[model samples]
Target: MTADISTPSRALDTDSTLPADAAAPASVTFADLGLPATILRAVTDLGFTIPSAIQEKAIPALVSGRDITGVAQTGTGKTAAFGLPMLAALDPSLRRVQALVLTPTRELAMQVAEAIETFAAHVDGLQVVAVYGGSPYQPQQRALRAGAQVVVGTPGRVMDHLERGSLVLDDIRYLVLDEADEMLRMGFAEDVEKIFGQAPTKRQVALFSATMPPQIRRVAAQHLNDPVEIAVTRQSSTVTSVRQTYAVVPFRHKTGALARILATSDADAAIVFTRTRGAAEEVGSALVERGVSAATISGDVAQKDREKIVERLRSGALDVLVATDVAARGLDVDRIGLVVNFDLPGEPEAYVHRIGRTGRAGRTGEAMSFVTPQERGRLRSIERTIRATLEEVEIPSPADVSAHKVRSLLTQVAARQEAGRLSMYQGLVREYVTEHGIDPIELAAALAALAVGDDGPRAREEQERFEAEREQARAARRTADVRGPRREGDRPERSRGVRRDAAGTRYRLSVGHTHGAQPGGIVGALTNEAGLNGSDVGKIDIFPSFSLVDILAPLDADAMDRISRARVAGKPLRIKLDEGAPVSRARTARPTGDRPRGAHGPAGRHDERRTERREWAPRDGAERKPRHRTA
Candidate 1:
């Protein structure tokens, strides 16, 4: 049978107390969705007062056995949307794996399974098990044998279970693919197909995603049977309590800049995000060298070891965890006072996910992204996606750090004085003065100086030197010109998808509108793979069949080589220096022998050379050529 597919077109549910969309029934209690009384009581005991926008719409539809395609952010209570209904529909008498949930990451799988367990906490004879990689297989197999009603797992691990005949989908009445787009990005499309092929043909399919691309739509059309569409269009994904800010630090000065920021901030616990596992370790090591209490985790870390690190972070035993996006998954810490994006996430959704880690549970938090001058364009794209302006802040100088530390010391002294704890110290100072013939005030000043430490002042000279070199780099960037008077390898700027800047040469990317490319995807690929900051990227002008971007800093031999071979939007970009002239309709019918009209030759664009990675992260305000979509 052909599947039924629908696109979500609806208003957002903004009110926390009530449903904001007209379609979703207002004042929806969990009971409104025909949830079993036992399940309702369980969720209520967990302090869930009302159904969220997604939950309000999804629960009722899913409970009625209708396939559903839901579009909502990660934190909008989606787990409950699918979990409660799956529980309600399950027949407790039949204890086989009635429902199977697939996730992209082990962390998400564990989270979903745990939530289902909580919902079924009071339901006797309803067993739930979470199976994922990096854990013992025997225990998972044992749980399956114990007759679990629900099984949640990542795609790869699930496939392994299916191959070994330890797990079967023949009884799967409800099948859910959470974060479906993420799964696709992580290369689970084939595994999903295999799993679906093995499942009961008549089972209900519910695919949930934050964004739906053509690939996801195709999957839905192939599987879902007349799915109901539920979309919650929130203006932004960032939690309202997070304050976003950025600093335009050059690549070379990032370490010093980070030090200054950390010295002045009042964060008790923080997570420093980096682009790669190697970078995570490097950043963590650097932070420790700078005297910050921190640790690092990545995919290379053992599972047991990773869990211990996360536990340490939760209990405040570790002040920070420098991590890649994957490693930070499944981590829930309330004491995270700040989040530092040492490198921007290539995936747009990841930006929201990172900041969402903080400012949770009604607590205020801060997030800062370190931007290079050239990466400003990518930064702007991120801002547009979030629909909020990130306040641009200057890097705190050495003097600034010193002054802040001094204030902190004085504040401590004031607190002690208020508590009457200074009397003992006062007597000690008196004794020192009496014995050494020194002024008591002078002795007190000496003690205060010792407590404050001298690192801030001592580092002043290095800071000044660094600032001078950084300015010189910027100066070179501003004065260098690669534009006119083309060299042999340089093509026309129009075809190259690059713009010449005073600081660096521009190369046009081979992929663009004609190849289904978007600026967000392009920027994400560059920053994620090349380790380039958003500020390092200059203006991005996307055209119907091409794009032009300027790089503010001249990439060295190694950097240029990496970018030339980089792939974006599933296409290897054959980038070359811009030198060819624009193609016009006038050449459409002209003979091959006809002389070229423009100054440049009629030759084509290039001859070769070219993350949690973002497939598409959109930027605001780009001139796009419209195309029609046939339903």
Candidate 2:
């Protein structure tokens, strides 16, 4: 059935129209949708009882060989909606690439590929290959040459394979664009168009996006023939059972802030969402160091390893899973009681999807987002989209963390006591009291301190120190805000501020103006990777080829290594001590202005590039410098 596809600028109501619910009944199952037994068995094994709104509407049309454009949000069973139908129609005996699914990110590609593999499990000889960047190309090339019937990948990597002749679409009968709008947003429009050109003209196409922007609609009009248009709109974007809140945190203190939040939260399990894969690794590692049982999942993580991590989360062996948005797609874990947005999502749709990970199956959940002062606007957009105003909350302080930890330990002790396993420990404690002639209460208190690793005064000192650094970071940001953006003329002013601290150490970074490196991005990279506060970072000089920054002296080898590996403007810092040259002066111009408009081109015209990563962490031995926070 044909339908009028409406765009914001125009409408195509001349064609026939079909009701979205025409085929879907109040009770519709996979069997009712005419899915083959092979696909049905996998669906049943996945424990899916009924189809989702989009799946109910789109499955029949797709399986019937009709091109379709679907409007549905992420996490609404979009994968199964398209995947099951595609699998039902594919020829397993044909070992060529019969189908290609293009996604916006590597994480999404990996997720879609895995889901399709599960759906095609009962269909023998049906091989699915996932290819994306940030991984070795040799393995992907080998997989492509192995006669895989289905290939799922990001547009950039797919183009790379096409140019290299490793992947051929001559026999492609099915082409799907998942999250089409996101691909366009990430500047993959050109790559996507080129892929469309390479695919066979007779292929059946399916395009699904959360929103139908003008560009996407235009593409559909130009390519899709008398297509079926299906839209699944939600009355509300957020789950009512999820208690949502926001915390205002400086970027440099987010890691510490997140640690405190997790320590205090009563959630059975948590998922921390970061915007970039690098941030996921960094945050996951930092959480482990801070004694949180956390693991990371991203595009870079292998599919088999991701399954293991999810299993750990399900079996209660892991308390937290740090992931990028695309990495966590289709991840279902009933115990996820909390979802923390370490970095506010760029899109409100993503915010909804992130929080949806929790509050599932009628269970109440909690979602907390960490927002820098500059991100207050984005936070408002999210509220508008979710149709709920999130209550503002405070990050737990060091004292709060300590108290929570103690409470948790005491609860464990109570459980151990109830289990009646304390006889040996009690006897030992009694002997110690008798030998020392100490009060039983005093001895017990001492043992409890030892058990909890409370080093008396030193523990108090450490807590106080952390609190001080946190406050210092806040104050530095406030001062920077009042002073406004720094200029080349402000270098001397910055120099005076640096000299006030213990002699700062100068470090050089490989990224500079030529790499689109800006001071705010550099500071963010350092604070996030090195776990240093904004206050701890020093003067930044953006030269043409390389930049120099002053940091607190005597950084440990581990911190230095992290800093060296930190990335800014899509390039590693490769940071080192700036002892090579006595530069006369720093660059006079600010690098924060808009890039040459036509040079890199506008938002939609540029080639796909990695979005700049934003985050922070904490470290020691850095002298306080003037600090600034970017939105």
Clashing residue pairs found in predicted model 2: 528-616, 531-617, 531-618, 531-619, 552-623
Alpha-carbon lDDT, every model = 0.68, 0.71
The TM-scores of all predictions, comma-separated, are 0.52, 0.61
Residues 360-403, model 1: lDDT tens digits: 55689999999765565567668877778999777776767767
| Model 1 ranges off by over 4 Å | 1-26, 73-76, 91-96, 104-149, 153-157, 179-188, 209-218, 237-242, 247-263, 266-365, 369-381, 392-403, 411-446, 452-631
- Cα-based lDDT at residue 380, candidate 1: 69
TM-score for predicted model 1 compared with the true structure: 0.52
| Model 2 regions more than 4 Å off | 1-25, 185-187, 211-214, 235-237, 246-262, 268-337, 340-364, 370-381, 392-399, 408-444, 456-465, 472-631
* lDDT at residue 159 of model 1 (Cα atoms): 78
